[model samples]
Target: MGLNVPTVSTGKKYTIEDYLKLDDGQSYELIEGELILVPRPRTKHQKIANRFFANLDRFVLMNNLGEVNGDVDVYLEEEVVAPDVFFVAKERLTIVGEMNIQGAPDLVVEVLSPSTARYDRKKKSRLYFRNGVKEYWLADPDQQLVEVLVAGEKEWKWIGVFDREDILTSNLLPGLEINLGEIFR
Candidate 1:
């Protein structure tokens, strides 16, 4: 599907207020002031995203580390993005506002779909890195792997890539581990 430009405004940079004004029942992300429509995920995409969210949510809740949420709008700087899965550390829960997350999450996960993989990997990653997101996970259903990136001094740094048989670990969420096999199953 091609990118759908919002009909609400022409040649204007969209803010969170403008994004809120969009009453259309469509998913969108404001990237550098442009309202980019996001397509619905495919079945495989949904499955993978749900699996990841389940694992993370369970572990986070068990350890009392933070809150886990999926498919929620996160306000980042001047942009608004809905990460497939996101985690807010216990101390940063203040960013979790009633309407939407008021800041970047501690960790952001995006289950790659054909429609948004490039933006997820590049544009969104950079935005997350710039806005203080500590970790980023790219779960690719087609590749059956998850790539981990952590915030670095200048940009997002590649941490590791775990395949189906491997286990995933994170520095941000110290004791948590995820089995790639279970996630891809």
Candidate 2:
């Protein structure tokens, strides 16, 4: 799962239209203009993502708050990203464009894999914060932990890391609490 070679850069910048024109079968992300290949999720990563998605989906649906989606194209202007899971409140559905999300989502969840852990924590976190993502969650299956980050006016602020023993809760998604123990198990 480790990416022996770091990000494979194109050495050239690309536009959103150009990115869309590429083969959809391949997994990639447009980072600042560099087309970086995203590695396939490992079985453990997929399992964690699926479990978290199910929990978030159920909560959002029951409360009629918003919609929860997985691996969808999210357009952050020139940079297009596909977060592991994203949630947009019902009131902010306008950002959900026909092709892809035109703006940052209310909340984004990323299940870390060995290859993309650093990228997700560094590049993607900064991107999400700058683009107006209210909240971000980094789920680490190996550590069995979830790090919650809240967006501030200037930067992203760390809320806290919840381990398997703690019940994960989101300040943005009020009443949306998830048991970490279930996810790690």
Candidate 3:
């Protein structure tokens, strides 16, 4: 028998409070008062995300810049998102509450998977930009590429795209560089 999945009523606009009441094991994000189901990532996606988290966490810890986290609930103004990987700067550490991040993170990384690439590239990026996230990284495992974007006055400005042999650097995290080969490996 298939597992009984929890269901939310149709046409009902949900809030963060309503989202929190969900006890289902599946992952979900609240956007525009709607609950978006997050599909489980594949092995390649997991590896890329893990590599990013490892490198970022190590660098941030060694430099005492801030904290690095993976797949944690982030509470924005009216949305709750779980970035693949994220960093909170030392100055904004207060936003990292016990249960979930209370505000926008300094850097938000999303590993692109076939199921959610469109949302990650457009809707989610816009949401993060509007919510004060300083930087956004979209890692594409299939393409062996990473695209960096910095928040602009009105939208997200493209920084650059790095390939397998290139080294990825961040404007937010100065002097912090990551080898793309290692990330895509």
Candidate 4:
């Protein structure tokens, strides 16, 4: 799942709309004027994403918190990031427009693929924080843990870590906890 860093030609300015129009046979993400094209992950990565989606969907539905699905592009004025599984509250569903989501979701979860791990942990985290995302979860399959991010006054802060055999709880969804062991399997 190793991916090369997306090369940004020097001295070229690109708008958010300019990135969406790129059809170079690769998936590109526009973040803070940088263009990153992350290559598709391995089969194992896809399996992990699908499994996470199943558990996430079950938890969200059981608690009636929100809805989650893959392949949903999220708009943040300067960029678009599509998580492995993205969830937005039913009440805030109106933010979705004809083109893309008007803003970030209440909960954004991304399964770590080796190719995207660096950006997922650093760059994307910052982008999500800047865009007013309420909660962000970074699930590391290799490490078998989930790092939970909650918005702070000026930035996003890591609130907790759910390791294997531990439970994850979110302030956004009271009394809803997910066991990490099940997800690791």
Give the residue spans of candidate 2 off by over 4 A. Answer: 1-6
lDDT (tens digit, per residue) of candidate 4 on 1-185: 33345746566667877876887887767777777776777776677778778877888898787777775678888787777787788898887666667788888888887778778888888888888789999888999988899999998887988898898887987776777887787
User: What does candidate 2's lDDT look like per residue over 38-122, in tens digits?
Assistant: 8888899999999999999999999998889879889897998999988999999888876678889999999998778888998
Stretches off by above 4 angstroms in model 3 are 1-9
Question: Who is ahead in TM-score, 3 or 4?
Answer: 3
Model 1 worst lDDT window (10 residues): 1-10
**Candidate maximizing lDDT:** 3
Candidate 1 residues lying further than 4 Å off, grouped into runs, are 1-10
Q: List the residue pairs that clash in candidate 3.
A: none
* TM-scores for candidates 1 onward, in order: 0.93, 0.94, 0.94, 0.87
Greater TM-score among 1 and 2 belongs to 2
Q: Model 1 over residues 126-147: C-alpha lDDT tens digits? A: 8999999999999999999899
What lDDT, from 0 to 1, does candidate 3 have?
0.89
